[model samples]
Target: GSFWINAHIEAGKFLWQRSNKTLDSNTRLRTTGQPGDLDSPGDCLSLLVSEDDLEYYPGLPYNPHDCSDNQHYPLCERILQDTQQLLKDPLLVLEETISINIAKMENNVHLILDTIDKSISAH
Candidate 1:
């Protein structure tokens, strides 16, 4: 559970970084009004270096799958899927735990009521 939660947290951080980069790029484009500025040699180099750095990270692996079907970036889509799975795991565990506790509580209640009935009958 902790592992999944940690993975979800890390994925959230990676997604935040990606969105910030996109926002920065968009802001730069809007201010410059020059598409070529976005493809400048320095910008390309920096992008490459940042991507390489991400490769060294444990979480958020880059998926090569085509994201043409979805509006989101491939990595973003994969991260969302992972997040859903991670959330489901914890919920499932909680659900099972609750059911087990409910069963135990029901048994205890039955025993208590039975004991009360016996005491009242003896009186």
Candidate 2:
């Protein structure tokens, strides 16, 4: 889910930069609950999460529950195991269609200052 996300940037020089459209994409990679799925919104997934997750990750409210501990709470042990395994991979929650490194992306943005060298070429 949340796989496809479109982003557009306007390229300009000596004047202004703009876009007729919004900076958003229509990437499709979803997993909606269906019959016999058993992973419906208010089912296994719902029963797995905690109140903190619902508040922090409003998007993936049940994500937290998946990692919730068993033998101590009312949640199922299988759910916790699945959730723990999911977190083991640094690439969890990210749709395969949207493969990206957030740290690298942020670094690229912050490195813009280096481009100043080309701002005014010397004769």
Q: Find the candidate with the highest TM-score and give its number.
A: 1
RMSD of each: 11.8, 21.1
- In model 2, pairs of residues that clash are 4-27, 6-24, 6-25, 48-65, 49-65
Which lDDT tens digits does candidate 1 get at residues 39-94?
Answer: 33212111112454355533433221122223222222233556678989999999
TM-score per model over all chains = 0.38, 0.20
Pairs with backbone N, CA or C atoms under 3 Å apart (clashes), candidate 1? none
User: Model 2: how far is 36 from its true place, Å?
Assistant: 36
Identify the leading candidate in terms of lDDT: 1
Kindly give the stretch of ten consecutive residues in candidate 1 with the minimal lDDT sum.
Answer: 1-10
Error of 1 at 33 (Å): 27
